[model samples]
Every structure is written in structure tokens, then in C-alpha cells.
Target: MNKNIILIGFMGTGKSSLGRRLARRLGYKFVDTDSAIEEITGKTVEQIFRKDGEIRFRSEEKLLVRKLSGQSGLVVATGGGMVLEQENVDLLKQNGVLICLRAEPEVILKRVKNKKRRPLLSRGDLLENIIKLTKERESAYEIADFSVDTSRLTFDEVLNQIRKFLQQEGYIK
Candidate 1:
């Protein structure tokens, strides 16, 4: 059975981008949970947030996590707040190595500020919101098996760190 590599982090932390690269390197399938949720609900994430509210969107996210937990040979980029629920962490860990990607508040704000798709930052001071949300989710994100700050690291450097961790954990050769 092929184990999975699951990336968990705040928005703009390189989960999706790094997940794609990691999947390619490991010859595994890549899944962005947010995109999958969008596909499943027939609505964009923003639409879901706008129409159904965050609570409803989180419900959909949980269901998707349950579904992904049953699969293998995947690299999943999870929604920012997915790990806030212990159940989601437990389910993913059954067949996955959870890696948290992190960045400073300033870096996060710079990376995500112009992206209108981020509902959480759509209404507030971007940097302040990033800091606030980071604080709120800090403990939750600690559930990850491994973590790396992507702020000063190049893509290859970040990938190498994750690869090294995966190797140490026996998830890769």
C-alpha cells in the first residue's frame, strides 16, 4: 500500500504548489482539497463561503477529508483550517505523513494580498488578518508530523527539506 503525503498550512504557504511538485517527484497523484471541494459542490470556494457560509463549507471539507483518507499514493494539499479538527488529522494520518508549510505574517500577506479568492482576508487588513489567523491556528497546525518555513527558502530548498523528512520517515527512498 502506498502511503500519502499531506500538506497542511495557512493560505499562501506553498501547500498547493509544493504538493504538485512533490507529487510529481514521488510519482503520486496530487489533490488540492479546496479545489476538490469546489468540484464536489459545483461552486468555487468563494461562492461556497459567500452562499453557504464557512460552517457549511467546513462540513463539505470534512466530508472530503473522509473520502481522501481512503485513498493512497496521493499528495494532498489541505484547506488551511482542516487540521483544526482532530478527526481530520487522525483520518489522514492513517495513511499519510502530514507536513505543515509555514511563513511569516508579512510574507503570507504579500503572497496572498492580491488574491481576491481568499475569503478570510477579503475584508480585513491583510497582514493583521494573517497574524491573527496564524495565532488562532498555531496549536492546531502543530499536529503536523513535519514543518518547514517557506519564507526564505527556494522551492528546491523547501522540497529538499520535505524530501529529507520523508526519507527519514521511510516514505521515500
Candidate 2:
């Protein structure tokens, strides 16, 4: 697993969970880009959004990706909106096998329903925002090398699918 396995997805799509498990299985480092940003800035993602606004948070995110591009043997779980920008995708893909995890809007809502940390879902209407954001990001996500819909699958199933993808892509033995 020389190339990083970069997981890109909407907020509730299991990028972080799967990335952590994949990293453990492969004995590679696991990095959640959002957590990295929070660590670097000394502020939570919601704080960044509330205090400085999303543009600033995205700027921080871009910087993080730029830094991560120079490293190796890590599974990167990107923030939901990371793929919204083409340049982010380009930089991450330069040394990573980018895979997008996917799920239905309803499924996503169900998963994130109780997660108050999601800044994007701070709006009053959860389901509506999920539908709108999913539509907005679908095209960008389509650029991934492969897609895994974890809406119904267990984590083990998701892991198997990702393992198979990595093996077929020659990233793993």
C-alpha cells in the first residue's frame, strides 16, 4: 500500500470509519483531514465555520491536502466538501488512490441525524439539506476511481469491497 487510500464522501458516508479500519488492516497511518485541520488550527471544525466562516476552513483544508500529498502510506479520510473543489482532487490524486463512498440522502440523514458536529447540517432542515448537498456534489464524486455504497452493507462488507478494489488496482498484494 504505497499509494495512500484516499476516501472521499459526504458527511455520513463512512469515510472516517472505513479509513481507520483500512489503515489498521494495512498497517498504514490513518488521517482524517478534518481532524488534522482542527488540530492544526486549535479549533474545532464547527468553531472554524462559526468564527472564520467556511471559506477560511476550506483554505485550511487545501493547505492540509497540499501537505498530505508529500507523504505516503496513509489512508486519508477527507472532509465532505473536499471534493467540491477540483484542485483539491488533483492534489490528493497525485499520490493517492481516490475512492468515493456513497449512500442515499435518506440513508445519510439517518446516519448523521444525531451528529451535531456537522456544520453543514446546522440548518434547521436536515433532510432537505442532505438532498441538496448530495445533488451538488455528485458530479465531483463521480471522478473517483471507484465508488462504494455503504448504505446497507456492514463495515466488514465495506472493508472487503475496498480491499478488493485496492487489490485489483494493484495498490495491495
Candidate 3:
């Protein structure tokens, strides 16, 4: 059975927060792809987007995903747009149980509004952008093995849902 768990969803769906917690509970190392990108480039994701644009960032992401997807025993928190690339999705599936975290656009916006690192959300019309992007990404997210609506769930609640999924899937006994 695959020991890695990969979380994918729209931005502000609590992937980062939940990744850290889930990793701790399960004794796995957590990797947030965005943070890894920042570390490798020595710049924040916003800086990457500003200097290299989304295309460049995505190419870099593809390379990184190719490498990271081969690793085991990790809890990976993926960027919101990771699934836009079929290659990334296939790579992640090679050794990971992909789970989608979902939440309402209003909830997502409220959770992310204070964060300065979100390049895409920095543009005008935050709410509309959330709606648009989430709609566009719905199919990508729907391919997950399981999805949990986190709009009103607490961290523990979300974790509980994930734990249940893992148990049911026989990833955990």
C-alpha cells in the first residue's frame, strides 16, 4: 500500500494546516510543495510568480513533482493548481493517496485574505477570482480518491474524515 498522502484542492482549503497535523498524527514528514519551491528558489511563491510568471512556476513545479512523487512516507500538501497538469496528477498517484480538500469560496477567501503570499488572490476582485478558479478546477479536484468539505469543519474534524477514508481504504488498520 502507498504510504504517502497527497492533499490537493483550491487555495485556502486548509491543506497546509491539515498536512502538518496529519503528518504529526501519522508519524510522516510533511512537505508543502509551495514551501519547497520557495526554499529552492530562495524566494516566496509571490516572488516566483512576479519574476517568472505562472508558466515558469508550473514548469518548475512539474520537475519538483516528478522528483517528490517518487519519495515515500510523506504527507504532501500540493498547490491549488497542481492538478491542472495531468503529468503532475499521474506522478502524485504513483505513490500517494490523493485527497481533495474542499470549502466554499467565501470561506476560502476569508481564510486567505490576510495572507500576503497568494499571488493569484492579490489581483482585483478576490471573491470573483475564488469562484472562477474553483469552478475551473472542480474537475481536477473531483478525481481525488476522496474529498472532504472543509467549509465548516475544524482541523480535527477534517482530520477525522481523512482518517476514516484511510481506514476504509485499508491504508490504515
Q: All candidates' TM-scores? A: 0.98, 0.98, 0.97
lDDT of each: 0.93, 0.93, 0.92
**Clash pairs, model 2 backbone:** none
For model 1, how does the per-residue alpha-carbon lDDT over 129-163 read when each residue is reduced to its tens digit? 88999999999999889999999999999999999
Stretches of candidate 1 off by over 4 Å are none
> In candidate 1, how many Å is residue 63 off?
0.9
lDDT of 1: 0.93
In candidate 2 the C-alpha lDDT for residue 44 amounts to 97
Q: Rank the candidates by TM-score, best first.
A: 1, 2, 3
The number of clashing residue pairs in each candidate reads 0, 0, 0
| Positional deviation of residue 53's Cα in model 1 after best superposition, in angstroms | 0.6
In the range 102-149, model 2's lDDT, one tens digit per residue, is 999999999999987999989879999999999998898999998999
Which TM-score value belongs to model 1?
A: 0.98
Model 3: weakest 10-residue lDDT segment is 1-10
The order by descending lDDT is 2, 1, 3
RMSD vs true structure, all candidates: 0.7, 0.9, 0.9
Across 108-146, the per-residue lDDT of candidate 3 in tens digits comes to 999998988889889889999999999999998988999
Residue pairs whose backbone atoms clash in candidate 1 = none
Give the clashing residue pairs of candidate 3, or none: none
